[model samples]
Target: MKKKTFWIPIIVFIVTTSVLYLCGHLFNIESLKWFNFEETSNGGFTFGGSLNPIIFGFVIGFIAEWIYKSRNKNRTA
Candidate 1:
């Protein structure tokens, strides 16, 4: 990957992971089993999520990078 485009994937991965975690924590989405929130004595939820977010983030980031490259290619062609 080009140096310029490399940041795209990294940024996308960070953003995706953050948003998913936030949504899971705030909304308590039952669909995502990874965001296993356990209540503590303080009445606050603890994050027990798995690495699924990392994997999914990487995948989405790759797709975003590919799309960006394709668009840039077409524009320069």
Candidate 2:
């Protein structure tokens, strides 16, 4: 894969995760609570059931990259 193709998904994943987490926390949405950060006993923090977001973000990232590639390829061809 090209550098942009590889990095696009990663960037999208990061952005998606960050945005979801922030929205979940800031909005105090019950359904999105899983994306919020949880306080641990050790004065540190842990992700609150972030598995869904991780998978969702990755899938969304790949889909976005796929669409982007297809559009660009069509344009060039």
What lDDT tens digits, residue by residue, belong to model 1 across residues 1-77?
Answer: 48869898899999998777677667777543455667899888776656766788989999999999999999999
> Distance (Å) between predicted and true CA of 57, model 2?
0.6
Instruction: Give candidate 2 misplaced runs (Cα > 4 Å).
Output: 34-48
Q: lDDT of all the models against the reference?
A: 0.80, 0.79
Instruction: Provide the RMSD of all predictions against the true structure, rounded to 1 decimal.
Output: 4.9, 5.3
For 1-77, candidate 2 gives per-residue lDDT tens digits of 48888888899999987788677668887455564566899899866454656677989998989998998899889
Winning candidate number (TM-score)? 1
Distance from true position, residue 40, model 2, in Å? Answer: 16
lDDT of 2 at 11: 94
Score candidate 2 by lDDT: 0.79
For each candidate in turn, the TM-score is: 0.69, 0.68
TM-score, model 2 to reference: 0.68
Model 1, residue pairs in steric clash: none
At residue 14, give the lDDT of candidate 1.
96
| Model 2 weakest lDDT span, ten residues long | 29-38
